[model samples]
Target: MHIISGHHHISMLSKDAKLNNHFYQQVLGLRRVKKTVNQDDPSMYHLFFGDMSGNAGTELTFFEMPNIGSTVRGSNAITQIGLLVPSYESLVYWKERFERLAVKHGEITTYAGRDALHFEDQEGLRMVLQNNNGEKVPDTWQAWTGSDVDPRHLILGMGTIEITVRHLNRLANTLTELFGYVEAYHSDNEAIYQSVDGQSFGEILIKQDLGPREKPGKGSIHHLAIRAKNEEELRYWEEAVKERGFYTSGIVDRFYFKSLYFRESNGILFEIATDGPGFTTDSSIDELGKDLSLPPFLEGRRSEIEKNLLPID
Candidate 1:
């Protein structure tokens, strides 16, 4: 059985919460599904952007670190994030939209035989809009009607995340042996692995780079989270990771989903999160991301958390 379902979410660092929210919501046309604080560090904002419903595979989250420095790009890091759009035509729509909005982006190009548009957020967070023309997967992401972008051109979900590491064999072995990811494609220095039936959203592209370790700050990808079907599956992974002699964070309840965190041998953090008890656990769909939502453990300090967070409007 495939333990890792797909890309649950990719979390990054942002120096400015307001601009980050604006670029993602107004520019990229994603919905702010959740507004909360980082449980590990509640002073900083933990903002989540995804489809209207905030499905498991659609999330692109950020932790607002106002004083963080710029990211010094190098190896041993998640190099880029991939967002899936409906078709190749959607790339044209986004290209024109980015030009009009003055957002920096590259021309539509092919990556791994799929049409992709490379772009960067205001903070220089790297991302690619990949074409999901005929992938056989459930249509679970609900389109946000409020977005100015047409529903047909709306981003479907998260796609293959690009991770660059020095010791490719060690990381690749961990993924295939520990997580049950199968090698779908491979070149000399690059390899693609899929968790579920070679689905695009379930893929991870690994690039072997011998550069220095990345100095993470603003615009740096913090972690890549893969999906676990439920709490039971989450526990199984936690034990599985521990038994393999790797240190783990164990099963941590994030209120919405339980999570297990561990850094692979390459020093890249990976999170296994449950799919159940979603964002609606505290607020309804309509009310999602409108107000700050905290887990039960942090509810007592709501006032303090709210006061620290800068307004994102």
Candidate 2:
């Protein structure tokens, strides 16, 4: 059986944490759900933005890299993020809001049969706001009423993530055969796949490109994480990936959830992360992202870590 649920989160690189926070939280209306440091590099900040309460499928995270260079556009990398808006009318609402706020965005267009508005963040992180057309699937995402945008038009969660790769068959096989994603649509060089559950939150769009490998930098997506039900499912995926001759990170304790990382043949990093204990494990829902949080292993060094990082505010 396919253990993957939907997107757990997508992590990217950012040059300035404060500006990134403002663009996503104030301008885009996502809530800052966590303030923490990169698990591997404690000196840098890791921020998570999502629906209110930081549900699994809604998270968009970033690792602050103050000196990072510009991303070199190319293939074999995550190219764009897709966020879900409630309806086509919501797209119009966002378009006007983007103009009033001076946010860079394109005209509304159809993508995989859904109306979409493409936009870029301050650091040039590309994203599309796709109208979900009011899909009635059950979800955990909560609208942050504190946001400037109306709750009805608030971004519900992440949708289709676009990945550009040279070897389409190899990556497609990994997604379909390994991860159990089923192809839902295809045209020209692009194809859309959805998880077994067929939710909009679980879709992926693959673009075939024979260009050079992407040089990741500020605004470049680091990895796409899919949901695993729990630690047991995470372990199952680790062995499955390893048995398939792929290198796996094994089960990793991420505090909020367990995770396992592996790079598919096309060089795109994929992470299988658990759904809980979610962001609320450490901080209460009301107090999330108010202060820096550290896992138990890093708690002892919190002072030193905080000293090296700039405050998001």
For model 2, how does the per-residue alpha-carbon lDDT over 183-258 read when each residue is reduced to its tens digit? 9987778888888555778889899999888999999999999998988888888888998889988788889888
Model 1 residue runs over 4 Å out of place are none
Query: Global CA lDDT of candidate 2, please?
Result: 0.89
Residue 120 deviation, candidate 1, in Å? 0.3
Report model 2's TM-score to 2 decimal places. Answer: 0.98
**Tens digit of lDDT per residue, candidate 1, span 199-242?**
88888899999989999999999999999999888888888999
On a 0 to 1 TM-score scale, where does candidate 1 land against the true structure?
A: 0.98
Worst 10 residues of 2 by lDDT: 136-145
Could you tell me which 10 consecutive residues in candidate 1 have the lowest summed lDDT? 136-145
Assess each prediction's global lDDT (C-alpha) against the native: 0.90, 0.89
TM-scores of all predicted structures: 0.98, 0.98
